[model samples]
Target: MDQDLNVVRGDSPDWRPPNKLLGQYLLSRLKLHGDRIIQAYPQYNETVTAAVVAERAVRYAATLQSLGVGCGDRVVVCCGIHPHYSSLLLGTICCGAACATLNNKFDSGDLRRLMEIIQPKVVFSMSDAVPQLQPALSQLATIPKLIVLDDEDTWKWFINNKIAYHEPQGIDPYTNVAAIMCSSGTSGLPKAVQITQANLFTSLMAFKHKDAYVQADDIVVITSPLFWVTALLYSLASMDHGVLLVLEFGASEEHVLGVIQQQKATVLFTASNFALSIAKQPSLNSYDFSRLRIVIATGTAMAMDTQILVENFFGASVVQLYGMTEILIATGMTRKGQRILGSVGLLVPTMKLKIVDPNTGISQGCGKVGELLFKGPQVSPGYLNNPEATAATFDAEGWVHSGDIGYADSDGNIFVTGRIKDIMKYRGHHVSPIELESILLSHPEVLEAAVIGVPHPTDVEHPRAYVVLKPGASVTADSLAELVASQVAEHKWLHGGVCFVNSLPKSPTGKIIRSELRYLTES
Candidate 1:
């Protein structure tokens, strides 16, 4: 490891804070103040403290063990925006079993497909989601056990009569799978990504060194759902850091600002869109954000203009992070490093990053745009049960192909251009959609935009744009086309014209589904 990136182990005589495994570190916090409120949900007026969370975790683990969930067993956790869901994930980790967090928005078809692929032994789903999953219940023949998160009466009966609550037994963290989160499925179907205990612990350690913003006294607000890796990892990192977590079921600008003021939140983890929404809120200026120290924006790329707005509004720089479900988070731009407009900052302490040519597979020098590759303890072992996809993603040397096109500057700052598969080929010339999208988004009227390649009758391909205009703003297709033509080269211009849409289709993680856009055009 580089001298600057060296971390102190827990056993070392000179060891500092944040050295233990994520589970153990969380347990220590729980032991310290079991009654101190850890998470609060305003919509339902629900709250959980360290002591209550610990007891529930222990009871849930005992319930899982009694239901035949042992070490190595896969437990599918379909959680919504609730603190209990997070507690259950921690409980599953303590029981030495893998927990797969399924997206609650997935309908019956999506659930059935994932169920067939993962073949989980047991499923823990919220009551609201259980109704949607009812159609696929028969398809999940492999899942012999099911635990509904709602039905308080049932949960009470289980705790009171079904089985006696017992403390979680000792677990070997190194050999267990802490959590399993799926890829965004932007280009294709989603793949299950196995996040082991080591992966979670390593990621938390890296977050401490790379972000290093969370503190014990900080109140961290989490608005993203627990199904995504960013939210799950943030929760774990906060727990490990012994910080108070304020969980929100959904993003409500009013509710968020209220919680920040009432709870005195010091840190926040959310998407760039959500951050932009918060910044755009006129009411935000009235509230005092003096306690807010750090705000992490992930799931989508952060535009420079949006970053500036957030910094100016909150008096805190937005920490931009580039990550995926497959590798968790490998690169992040600290609040201090946001001076470089589009850079994603340096690689994490325990991670290694490289940009390689797509055709040659050879490492590219700085400033050369190519496919980004990463290798670290936080990298997933492989896709669950998809050997072909796993083999295709991981090289012989264990580097995970990120499929993202980016370049590093001389100062070691990383800049993501676009996805390898999303790049457009116009008459044999390669074009990055992100470059076009960024230029279009710079327009005062254009709120969000996506660029896709459409088949041309004469040449290789042509650029097409699907744009969502800012509220109350009016712009014709000709004006939008003229806007791009004036800024970009003739070859890079949108020859296929702009298509107006009410809203662009996006994945659950907030990435634009360009493939779907192309499909819509062709159909």
Candidate 2:
């Protein structure tokens, strides 16, 4: 037996840790902005005040407690963008249990796979998503208590049985899991990234220091699903900043623009492609977006020209954010008037970024492209129950070896070229899929584009493009090939040719599925 392994050392240096849990922090916001309307849903024509939200969250937590949920239990939220998502998530965390979010877009098979992994204690599904979830829930060995968010009977049961609000005592914020958000499954199946309470608080603090920091009385709108880590961060940021958050489930371009005009939303958070959609929508001029001061594009990289177009049209500053589930909001651009093309902006506060050779472990100097390694308090502890992946991705010093390839200039502006796995090799020359995709997006006729390397006879590999054109827009493949060739080197040119598709496959967060494109090109 390894008796010495369990030995405890003498008193060691103790550092300051976040004193509050994720739910407690958000609950405090209610006291600060009790009278203000903190959440508005234009779709339902409903508005909820901060005080009301706090009360609802407490009651919801009591309901979970009454149902025998306690510390370390997993509560899965399987629904679309509902107004009650914030309350449910806060309630789950308030009970000292972790909240796992699942998108309603998942089918029965997908749900079954994820359910087998998470093994949640309770599952909260909106009335609309219950049908889709039933099959998966039935197949589980032990059925979790199902609570439908929109059902009147469920609400009555929770409200009648609700107890007094009780703050979880002796909870360690650093070790307590806060939420389990799924990674973008671009290369493979999505892994459950376990974010701790400390990580969530640190992420909030980092965004608090940025130029796009949420302001008091600000009306913020997020277009992405609550399941996405970025959108969840925005939700928490809104509460931390005492801002009114407006949400519309399955928001279309028209719905988003209309909500902004009607609500006079001051800040917008959305996927880069959604922002581009708003800019390209023919009815954009019909909506008034003058109240918008800051717009953040996340999920995927936005073409510099597309950023300019959105900024010009909305009369708001557009900044691109580079982050993932593993490390939430690591880097973001916040320049108000000036625009930096192809830059994700300066490193976020309390974070350190280093570039190192992917093959060799040697560090790369500034302005050199290599894999980005990030060390920060906001980084996730690791993927859940996946020690092999955890060991491969995280290091002894707590640095997350991000598989992204990028570089920082002398001015400290970060430029993400592409993912290390997404880089295309042509005759031994490296080609950035992002570079080709960005150029293709700049074309007037192209609506969406994805680039991947395909097998070649002469060169070891060749660049291929899958494109989606604007409605009623016309452009030949050869012309598109010439357009890219003029911008990049010969080796990086589109030698594998272009395929026009109705739509490019995308992850839930709107990142293009490059692996799927590669599969299509090869097979």
Candidate 3:
């Protein structure tokens, strides 16, 4: 236990915010812009106005009420690339029912487990996704009524049909659940995080009133699907700020460039992997990104070289955010504190953070690496139907153990090295995969890289590199292995050797699945 308490509080700590429901807040703010374009999706050739979202919310809420969905009830949404996705989610919340969004890419097994946990009363699945989720829905003890969002008949009969319904009364925004987003962790099955109305409202307010500023005219281009928590956070913030949102689904690199040039998008928000991949495209340098001012990177930490490329290419401030499904705003680059390279920036106004020694149960000091713990107004209450997981991670004192290994510098810039579980133990020497991965990513030939611990007979585990080369790159494996070996200590060397793959397995969030890489080594 160090005498110095390594706790950091935001300059403007969170206070008791207004007791407003998330749906009401969104609709109220979004409708003010009226004719301003709220959302644009190329897949449907759709452009939605603020007025449409507000109107649809009221109508959809009535329909949900008619279908027997009341306060405290749950609804599941598996709509893929649906332009009205935001409206539907808002409607579910406005109608006094919490909603859970499923990643459309999730296998049937993952979908079934989440369905069992949420126990939703109704599911709004995309027409194509229904077949995949139908098997899981059938296995549920209490099957939820499935509503296909794309079907014209269902859309009319279920959503636009109901007109008469009253606002939910006696609702407590602070305690009542509003949204349950599944957390895609690095090494385990996803857990459904229960977010209250207050959590969502407070988080959006934090961005609105405090640090991250969004202009009314900013066309925020979002490539990640709406199901992702990070995407939802950005989407809600953009809407609340009355910024135009441009949503792209499975866009080609050339198509993305065309969107940026045509729309003159001001803010580009997506995962680091996606950003990095596009930054490497030769055509990207040709685009006139004069309007792009902010590039927000999520999912994985951006390597220095890749970050620099994005900043140079877009002429934008690269904001790499460190947030999770549990806490909507943990740390992010703010107006007060611009990001330090390789750091996740300072804690936002809504959060208070502490770094604690995991094994010793003692608080660490500045510049000392330890597991990070967080407590805040926007932090989720707990996991849905998973009290054991809730108890294990969230302490009685209200600190949620982040399980991340990191330290803060003198200026309070937090750099996340890697997860505690992801640290490779090579003959009692602790090695960070992120440390090695960064070195590999610096190489010109490497497009992307993931380091994982391979089982070693004599040593505990050896660090191995799984790399994806750039198109037409011809670097040998030994050259890349020697690159790491020359820079790091012997213990951190790539003893398990290096292997090049077309691509590394990744979570829907764009985080590399090292556990899957370990399986690759075994097989």
- Score each candidate by Cα lDDT: 0.73, 0.78, 0.80
Model 3: lDDT of residue 245: 81
Compared with the true structure, model 1 gives a TM-score of: 0.89
- How many residue pairs clash in all the candidates, one count each? 1, 0, 0
RMSD of 2: 5.8
Ranking by TM-score: 3, 2, 1
What digit string (tens of lDDT, one per residue) describes model 1 on residues 1-523?
1223221111111223355545557778787875777677776688777787777776777777787777777788786776677677777776778888899889888888778777777787778888777777677665456667677876665444445544345555565677888774334577888888877877776645534556677788877777888778877765565567787746567778778888888887777767765775545678877898878777666656657767677887677777878788877734454446766666665677777899999777767788888877778888888887888888888888888888877666777887888888887789888768767766667767889888887767899999888677788888888888887888889998998888888766566767789899989
Q: Which residue pairs clash in candidate 1?
A: 34-51
TM-scores for every candidate against the unseen true structure? 0.89, 0.92, 0.94
Q: Across residues 1-523, which tens digit of lDDT does each residue of candidate 2 receive?
A: 0122211111121334446677887899777888788778787788878787788789989888877778877889987776777788888889998899998888777888788777788898888888888888888898888988788897568656748767778888888998998874223566788988888887777655535446666888887787888767866776677778887647678878889999998989888877876776555678888899988888776667767777877888788888878988887734453447768887676667777789996777767888888877788998888777777888887877878888877666777888888888998899988878878877878878888888878898888899999888879999999999998799989999999999988777676777788777767
Ranking according to lDDT, highest score first: 3, 2, 1
C-alpha lDDT of candidate 2 relative to the true structure: 0.78
The better candidate by TM-score, 2 or 3, is 3
Q: What lDDT would candidate 1 get against the real structure?
A: 0.73
